[model samples]
Target: MNRYTFSTQSGKAYYCNSIPGFIADQSTDIVGRLVRHAFDINKEQANAWENQITELQRRLEECGMEGDIIFEYDIVRLGKRIDVILLIRHMVFSLEFKNGKDIFTTQDAQQAEDYAIDIKNFHKESEDLYVCPILIATDAARYPNPQSCDCYPDKQVHLQRENIETLIPKITKISSLYGDDGEIDFDKWFNSPYYPTPTIIAAAVEAYSSHSLSQIAQSEAGQENINLCEAKIYEIIEYAKIQKKKCICFITGVPGAGKTLVGLDVVAKSLDDANGLSVYLSGNGPLVEVLREALKKSVESNDREREDLWKRAKKSAGKTFDVPKPEKLFNKHTQAAINTLIQSSYAFKKDNASHSNPTPENILIFDEAQRVWNQEKMARKHDDPIMAVSEPKLLFSIMDRHQDWAVMICLVGLGQDIYDGEVGINEWFRCGIEEFKEWELFYSPLIFSQVEDKNIDQEKILSCERCHQIDELHLKTSIRSFRADKQCQFIDALLDNDPKQASEVYQQIASKYPIYITRDYSLAKKWVRAHVRGSQRSGVLACSSAQRLKPEGIYVPTEIDVKNWFLAPSDDLRSSNMLEVVASEFKVQGLEIDWAIVCWDADLRRSKNGADWDHYSFRGTKWNKRNKPEQKRYLVNSYRVLLTRARQGMVLFVPKGVDPEEDPTRDTEYYDGIYKYLVSCGIQEL
Candidate 1:
């Protein structure tokens, strides 16, 4: 089968003499070919493809262009396809045609630009090539002076169908600007490797709706690592099932390393198992809420399509069928089912703590397991002393109820514990070693490498007979920031007070992944707004302890509806795009935005001598130092979450403090040292 619906640059189609013949080919043949590649081709889609082909052929022939015209180019990450890709010389044109439309809309323009950006960022061969995104509204009035050649820094030009015939000459003149005059290799470009790092929300929705992550997981290296992790966990699950033994597996990775993706994939694949069920649990409330909401919307959409098909089938039978009252697919029962599949760890604990019976699910995947509460925190939250055990211990006891077989997979993130009483990975191992000795234990070798603090008893855990180290369980690279894999490393160095190393790493990724600093909050907002485009999300983020930022129009105390904040339309006031509401590290820990404005406050500021960070908390009107080790770690981790939340880029907004005499709490010394330190780390000032 062909990779695309049709191609004009392969085999006999490559010759310029055969171009006219190919253009004049029947639309039915092309439609039929596209139908074979698609799952369900509607009449509207078929007509659009036919019209796109006819319009494209006329434009190509009029321009006398001799290059490849790929119809229906697949963009696997988005689960959508570009209408056409015109590869002429060193230029790559991404075309999105709006059939029968007389006016261009913002949605269509953004869609066109998104395709170009995706190709430029993810497609290996198109990285350096000039990509022009054109939105052609077939019936729209032609622009008197179309800016077809006005290219952005990323080499993307948005244009209309008007004056498209003149595009070839303009493209030819700019080909020299790309530093390559040679013709593009059509085959190589068409078959180029595409590494798309989808947002976690996108991955979860795809996994739940399609029950397959093939389209979402596209990177060769990153996807292979995730797949291996999934496979190894499944192997352990199967062994436990066959041997009638309980087992637990720990999978660790750096921040944004697709650890959550592995857990979601395991749950998705396990749906096929009729013998048992799998559940994905997370302590992060916002992450669970967003995923469930996205998946619920997907379910409702699919149901609506099915209902439409049902109505059409009844009409075809020539029988007048009374339309039944619309039954909502995303009703209470459906929500209950969704909750069972992807649940909050706290809720899961509460539901099972009251019962001694075994759960129907034999496999449980814990996401962000490092954030599980320690015994002290758990005790204070629960009224009953019997339920006061640490989260891991309680979770293990629940799973241990299954006498025959059960499996538990913990997805651990390093340096992500941003809240009090959230014990790191040590709690899980401690529980496994001291309490659940009968259950077999498997962990990533990378866990030991990252344990800098001697809190975990590695020797005792490894010496156990049931404990085994598996190399495949650890993910090495960061998939979230496809533009910069070393972003986490840079953040580490910056926080570790190693400005030289941080500056060196920043230099390497400065061009592709922008990191800027600004003293003015408005300027930081403006910078993020300018960089965001095409449905990309940008938001203001502050640490929860940043109480002083309330004076700067950033109120961390404001409770944001995360589902709306992350998923609402840009025009909606509730949307993060509005930048009215600020999300704290607590709300956005496991989530991400395309661009971010990180508001810095006196809560975690550089020390007087700039030797280390000093942690502080706001009490009444004055700031008090937090000397506790746990308190200090949480303060640092809060910034870590905020710093790493941006997938594309971020702007650190360090407010200029007021005069000490006017307000001692807002002293300039509190912020100046940190701002200077950030500059020394190679963060460009806005």
Candidate 2:
């Protein structure tokens, strides 16, 4: 049959379980593998490449070409060959094929001429014939590295396939670039694997938005909030509009930047508009409980309206919409279960990636991105469970694909965080970690591709002492935060091991907002109870660590029972999984008080020999997931839930060591940097 057989001469192998019929059979040496190393890649890429081949055929036909479009084809038999064949206006015939490796030589020319003879003999065409051959090498650089698929001294065309796209534009630019290559062979292409003419292809894509983000056309939030705290909500809106990108702006902020408020604003905007889908994608346990209650209120507010729905639906289909009974939809237990399932071992990765139709008008906003949406690398074995082992650089690649279906992508979390080193910097900035790495397109699954920008300033972005303010145009002028925010700011700046950055946090607070050093929990409680009294939602999360809280405790709350509380995990992976049980218990009582009194419990003495236990152990070779042994590490992930909860504001319920009475402010300048910044901004003095 002389079927065109192709195989990787040498490369690494991969395994895929995407196809049921192609499932790997058990019992071989190195049994489970997929794509085995690309080239014939997958159904997706093969068609993508073939489409380019047909485009070239279309070009030939437009200039008056003809003949059999494709040879008798069978993928399993013929492999990746005979991309297309065309008969030109003047007794001229052509054959087109794409090679990952550039093959633009006499040998390649002979192969095409031979294909020409075969076509002629089989079809019994006219005797007068001229054969034209075109060899397309997609990645021109890799194929002939540094040598192009164009300007071949002896032969024709090397339409650049850098994007696997650009094939069309290149198709249009061909006649001019290659002088006398003739016309677009539309007839041949219409009959090739990449069916439908270029016009049809363009129309179809016009249906799907382009996947690109340009700085001049990107979201402005990063530039606006370059100076202050707060969600920089307005900027987010602008960015979404300009790029037309459905995205999740991953945000990592302290207690007061108003990430949630911004999220709410986004949700409200989504609901009111018809073009975008704006959803608060966080279905966390506690949060879902709150959402259910709110949903119930909505149902209560619209009981009569729903009855009308029942009447209308009954009239039409002889049935009711059933509306799922708002109560069932808003059941705390049910919502909690849904939240748990969404973040379960099964749903996290793929669900996050998939933004479904009947998709929201804009984006599905997700906060606490780091905690829940981990970029995990699943080390799956056929015998192993389906979950990925979760490496740090996991989803670093497909973040764009995840954002494409939406209008904007928002991620909020600390960057230098997850210090335990299970991930990579998903955000790229050439200068350092803090700045945003501007990207236009992420072409491959390898994640990022930097288009050469003549103006990427590696120079540091100028900023004031707060390290938050900058030259961004959209500065927020709202003081929606509070007093202890000063203390929190102090801890973040001056309490560092190396005494520097800021000298007086008091001054820092003054420049931004008023700083009140209060040592009364009752008074703090009074303020919280007064403000968040009924729907009064606020907390004074404690830092039992004496590590993060000690400084604030000195001037904040003096009498705290720092012993039997949570010390809070510095970085925890199992938070969402365990907190549900704990939250359900205390949340029922005042233990789940409207205001939380948090502190890093001084009791986590790192496991010596445990008590309430049985889990797994990966001791070198064998699997021992049965009991707590000396080699693993685990902590109550609830520490995050504690710090994150205040729907309003929080207090400094910290330990003494984490802060100080005499002031690391050292008589005056300890937080000088912060105070100076606040002073310049005209914030009241601490």
Candidate 3:
């Protein structure tokens, strides 16, 4: 059977006589499997399909068209199949059929547009073509003319029609205005390259379930490292299972090196084993929230009606489908559930008593393990109910309660600990050596050197009874910024006060991943807005301590809801795509955007010596310098997080300090020094 049930080349008649054959052929194609599955889950869809075919057959008989037609055409990598695709001269039409409907719903229109957008973004051959998505509600009144809107002009068109009487006329008019310069190669368009972009959540889910990383998109440069990381992780899991030993391994990587991906992948693939289940935990609240939501959305989108349908089908099979109670469905083995396998560290710690071990799950994967709280932070908070020495110590104590064997995987990112409570990587080593010596330890030899943790005594760690350093555990490349592999190196050098080296590294990657620096906030914003294309994400980010930035219309704290800001559509002002709101390091540390505007404030500035950092906090009408060493480190790391959050490029908006005399809090000296230091690093000024 053909991949598509029906397909014809451009400049050919799509005859109504072939509809029956197409339907018969589709019964054996991919769409057949989808339809059978839909019948078991959503019977309405199965009924709709029959009527849809009849309507399309009737419509084609009425509308005389000169184009290629494809029925049940699978879109690129989205796991979605478009109803029909009409390839005409210089234009492609995406048609959605609501066969039994009398009214065109908003959701129908959005789905049609989303299909067109997916095709345009993922289909390499369709990028230059004018793709118009039409929604046909067969029973609805016919709209004789297509509406004109400037929203996605030239690239997108929307049509709501009752029949195909006016469809040909509209297509002719659209072709006359925006048709391609020449005829397209039908064979090439049919086999165009598809670019798949699975979110970190989806990638993890697929990798875990499939026992392979083939589905996750990777750049040619980082594919080897990504594969190596996945292989090493799998080996560790198998070793723990075979050895029947309690082990803890640290997987360290540069910023955006897929550290979280490695953790999630391990958890996903490990959950199905009879030996033990795995749970993924993250100390980063925003990371956890966004990832959990994304995972929930992924599960919901794929099997929205699976549960109800399964219940109905099971009744006929003489099986019981227990109706869920009022409580939340967070049970093990319920793969369709939400946040069952993935959880937040704070929530997990809070729910489980310090001395209690809830599950026998042999493995616990910790993403951003370095962000775990220190002994001081946990103890200092008086009003908080839960008491723990440190997150690592607490984690070890709970896992120690395991009956036989267990493993804890810590996914670490270098220089990404951006909060005060964060104790860095040393806390885990200290906890393991000083307290949980019975648990076996395995980590990359580069962990100590990468974090530069002055608090760690390497000799004591090396002398630990069960400590083992594995070279395969360290990930060196930055997969996040595919445009420049060495972008993290430049950021590290700049943050480490090596301006000369930073400048040299910047020049090498400047052409590919542009980094713009400007004192004018508006110019920096404009630069970011102009650079981002298609649905490429762009946003403004600042350090959490950027209280003085409110004057520039960027209030980082209460103004932005990180979840909505990150996930909302471009039309929603709350979305990051609007560039109206700014996310702080706390909200955007692990995630990335296509382009970003790093709003530099007086929160962290270059010291007089021009080598070290001086941290400041805005208090009322004055700027107070924070003299604590730990605070200084966090303040510096905050900038590192913000700077590295951009996948493609970034622009720095350093305000010139509106007449420093009028507002002493906005001193020009504080802003100028950092701007000059960044300029010295070979970052271009707009």
Candidate 4:
């Protein structure tokens, strides 16, 4: 994909010869080039490009600057583009324009700053350089002093349009303090690979809008693995379609390895195909609600913009445009369309099981397939003894109703089954081997490396002629925490009670990814606030069973609106930025925050000998020990989910309990051991 619409070096000479003398063209000719690069150019976009180009050209001529000027630079990670970027003398200036506006808004400022942060965090060429984010409200009445504005710790400065010329000289004087990196090479910077780690919500919105994987995903970190997996799935799908056979595929990966992203990409591609139809089903209620709401809002905003642009285009052409009284020009943004593409797995099962007809969709993609309910849990949930079938078997029966061909793609995350009766991959294997012997199976090789359970018959499944192992189905890299790719390994070793291994891994990643331990709750919150920059998100997280933490201002029993908590603005009281409310593992399993404050409680603490962990449940007034194996495992996995939810870094808040005699539930011994244990594991103290 083309990175920018137009690029030219400052002064009279240009460096790039590919466009052939376009630098000497007029403003109208430059606007034509920008329009060519745009996928769908409307009147508003074209007019804005013209104005920005004309004004920038005048300013460059006045200042006599010597550097590169780029227009409409694409930031693929956010699915947005910068208005203008000026690279001059070891300084990168990101300019955001608000044409015909009289006032500057907080949202506009955040947008400008976010673009600069995206460059510093993801752009390999700008890692060590100084970045300045300037917001221009062309028609504003008052302009602040250029010297009065301060630079953020991340080296971003927010300024108005009037300060652009004056601020350039001031930044040049201070550029020496940032180290002399000399001039930036335009060719190397332009060709640098952009590896952006987008949030799951952002990825889903981009994918559902019909964007390809290359436009939405990272380029270097495991891009080949994801592509190979996608290709292998398509091959299986084609073979099944041509041979008129039913096939099942299993894709396993480490935590935050883009399993959901791969599934969403395939579903989008299937929708674009003329002959095939696919639906993405998930049992994660929070994930589904957040994604659907985000998509609806995006569609509404685009429709409104398009309508406004259409009216402007007609008026500019000197033609009379009639405004419809009762109807809208675009009505494609409907709830029914969104629901058809993404649906609840439970609702799908109930609807299909109530009827005897076959489904129209031939391809079914299941997210979090390991969390599907077993036979007993399904029966208990419905309060019906006759419902003896597991969810996997029921889904298989529904798909088997198709006469010609069908394909089932299961996205599994190992050791992520935190709830009871949420059968892991074993149930699907058993169903395929015993009940549905005719279905062909394709699986990742990682499935065999998991801890052996009595229910899984590895030998029997491997001996079956239909089962095939493919290495491409496994994603080995964790792209969620782009700062540290080995974060999952560190978390795994820490939770497994291997202090030596955890310490070793922590030493390797400490400089890039910070992990701190603190005894005061306020310190943890302060750390998160200090580390977060621009529009990056930060929130407080705690385990669901952390009842003893109520006195410390953390109440896990109160439910939060996942949509608002994850997507709301900073000033909103219900937003995560407030940090007054906390989300448990259940609310944030499939989501992530930029920075996190994990509130550690006595629900899971280190043993007296500091060799193992102890699990407990607070009932009524006192704490009781958890004895069941599944219950213990659930408590352990809850911390796993909480620890891995932050993309940047996190701080563990281990509060110091009061005297045991005054408060039996809040004993000093309960939390002290865990704090010391974490410190020994190489976590720095706050």
Best by TM-score: 4
What pairs collide in candidate 1?
none
What would the per-residue lDDT of candidate 3 be over residues 274-357, giving only the tens digit for each residue?
777888888777877877666555555446446544554455445453544223233344443346577878777766653465
Superposed model 2: Cα runs more than 4 Å off: 1-254, 283-285, 297-362, 370-405, 415-480, 483-487, 497-503, 506-596, 603-686
In angstroms, give how far residue 515 of model 3 lies from its true place: 4.7
Question: Candidates' TM-scores?
Answer: 0.90, 0.34, 0.75, 0.91
Residues forming the 10-long window of minimal summed lDDT in candidate 2: 195-204
- Whole-structure CA lDDT of model 1: 0.80
Better of 2 and 4 by lDDT: 4
Over the stretch 1-686, how does candidate 4's per-residue lDDT look in tens digits?
Answer: 53332244221111222212223458787788677667767666688777766666665655566666767677877778788777766778787877766676877877888888888888888877788777777777555544434555546554434333443454454454443558787777766667788888878778777645556666357678788888899999999999998999998888888888888888888877766788899998888888887777677767776676676666665545554422442356567777877888978887888786888789999998988899988987765343467989989889989889999999987677788888777788888888987799999767778522336678888898899998999888888888888888999998999878889999998877788998888888888987766678899999999998888988985578989888888889888888977999999988899999999899898888889999999999889999998899889888999999998899999989999998988888988988888877888898
Q: lDDT tens digits, residues 1-686, model 1?
A: 43332244232121221245447666677667667667665565667667766665776677676666766778777667787777766788777777666777776777788888888878889887888777777777765553645666676654444333443455455454543556777667776777888888888888877777765765644778887887788789889988998999988888888988888888887777797789999988889999899888878876886676556545543555555635667789878877887998888898899989998899999998878888899999988776798899999999999989999999888887777777777888888888888898999877887633347778888788888999998988888787788899999999888999999999998887899999988888888887776778999999998988877888985468999899887888989999888999989988899999999999998998888999999999899999998789888888998999998999899989889998898899998988999999999998
Candidate 4 at 235: error in angstroms? 1.4
Rank list by lDDT = 1, 4, 3, 2
Per-candidate RMSD vs. true structure? 4.2, 29.6, 6.8, 4.0
lDDT of 2 at 652: 31
Q: Identify the leading candidate in terms of lDDT.
A: 1
